[model samples]
Target: MTIFASYSIKGGVGKTALAVNLAYALREDGHRTLLIDLDPQCAAAYYFRIKPAAKFKFKEGPKLAGRLRRNIRESDYPGLDVLPSNMAYRNFDIMLDRLKKSRKQLRSILAPLAEEYDSVVLDCPPNLTLLSENIFRVADHLLVPVIPTPLSERTLEQLYQFFKEKKLPPNRIRPFFSMAQKSNRLHREFMAQLRLDYPVFLDTVIPHSVHIERMGQRRRPALDYAPGLAATQAYRKLCLEILKG
Candidate 1:
């Protein structure tokens, strides 16, 4: 299975949107996609219209981990398998610390599904922590959503440093642009700079649009709700680029 994680060290740069749309695009291609919602905000679930039942809540104290510990069955998510999260997930750090185990809990949890699904797309919270570490440990390809800006570009530097300090390999990371404004000169400049400098960055760019923003409010991926739209087509191309690698 190709385990692709969509994450960004910096928030508010459209990471979740790109992840959601790309997962939808993969599902449309007849691939059995497994999307794990790792963010404490639980936004991915909302986007998929998956309601949180009482069983989805934290059965144990101080942890927001999913209760479905088995290999994610097809029925876990009616359309596509989703390991949903709850608001209490913000407490997972302390809970993980209390266990005093390797921070690779997320990897061990997802290991069983490696045999079941074709692609495992994890929507991680935007930052480095125990959860991020475990996600990286298990990820085959890391999908970073970078905007066209200096600060966003700088976050890429910090991500490399974080791994360097921790003695982790950096080759698995793959970056792409989300909400790109092609009309802007700076966007063009950053794209050229990063593409020349970072060979791992993908080619397909997800352009900025009102349709993409409103997609979240409508509670569905733009590709699913409007596949004929320009944004959807761009996302599909991005999926092809991902599969190419």
Candidate 2:
């Protein structure tokens, strides 16, 4: 299986939304997908309508955690499965800070399952913490969602510069525009800059709309719920691009 992470350094950039829907879209195309909600908030589980109870709490006791981990490992969905997140995952950084192999934890957990599915989509947190670092280490591909704004662009530049200075590989760094508004002059200007400065940026761009924001409320991706919408079509095309890559 190919592991792809939907990530952003800034929150509210539509990263998780894209991750959730894109995984569904890939499944619709017949790829077995595992959507890994790596965000500590567990919003991905909420989106999938999974309720956590004391009996199955992922953080409670050793027996329950081990059982759930086995379940996650052996899970079989029709076309997809979810390795859901828990709120206690917020403590992952603090818990693993002194551990030498923290960055490899994610990779170790996933290596055996690498061939079990066609794709594993990780919905990542908004920070470059240890979790994000491990994500970087394991991901075969990274989809970075960049809002068409100065602040967002600055964050993207910072990310690129970070890896460049640290001498990390840049081959998998692909960027696509998000929350774009073609009617706005600023948005248009940024697109112009993106096309000029970043010639390889994906041509497919996600537009700003209530339809996209309503995704979180509906707890489903537009591709699943409103595939006729422009944003859904854009994300579908983005998924196609990812597959082609």
Candidate 3:
């Protein structure tokens, strides 16, 4: 299975929204997808109308996998499932610290799911913590949402530098413009500059839209409620780019 993580060192860049919508898109393409809400906020799960899962004590590998399995909830969309996050997820870094191969433990935990899922999309918390390192080690692709701005550019540079310093595979980082405003000259210029500098940036851009902002109120992916809209079409295009990758 391919593991795709929607992550960014900076929050409010549409990471969770990308994860939720991308997972739905993957399901629509006939892939059995599992969306795991790793953020303590559990916004991805909330989007799916799923409640926070009960937290459990971590044990051996089998037990841990069992716990994760029990927490998986079928979504309204066929071929898609959600493993909702809970407050206990805040302790994930601490729990990983206790493992022998802490930076790689998440990979082992997720390995068993390959037989059941064609794709696993993670809605990761925004931070450069130990847990973030673990995610970097495990995820096959890091889908980063970079807002077109100076600060966002610097943060993306920092992430690339971190990868170089830590000897992680930098090529795994696939960034794309999120909340892009074509009407804004700065946004357009910054996007052009970034694309020139970083050829790995996906061609698809997600536009800033009221429909996307209303996801909290709608409690579902834009494709579900606002299909045929530009924002929803952009998500589909992004998903196609990922699949092509």
Give the per-residue lDDT digits (tens) of candidate 1, residues 153-239: 789988888889888889888888888898999899988998887878887888998888887688888876687888779989988
Q: How many clashing residue pairs, candidate 3? A: 0
- Candidate 3's C-alpha runs over 4 A off are 58-62
Q: Candidate 2, overall lDDT?
A: 0.76
RMSD of 3: 1.3
User: What TM-score number comes out for model 1?
Assistant: 0.88
Q: Rank the models by TM-score, top first.
A: 3, 2, 1
Q: Against the unseen true structure, what C-alpha lDDT does each candidate score?
A: 0.75, 0.76, 0.92
lDDT of 2 by residue, 1-245 (tens): 88889998999888888887887888888988888877878776667665431234443332433444453521223677777776666766765565667777677677767677888899899998887778888898888988888787688788788778756777777788988988899988988887777676888898888887887788766777788988778988998987888
Give the alpha carbon lDDT tens digit for every residue of 1-245 in model 3.
99999999999999999999999999999999999999999999999999999868754454766786789999999899999989888888888787788898788889889999999999999999888998999899999999999899899999999999999999999999999999999999999999999999999999999999999999999888998898888998999988898
TM-score for each prediction? Answer: 0.88, 0.88, 0.97
Q: How many clashing pairs per prediction, in order?
A: 0, 0, 0
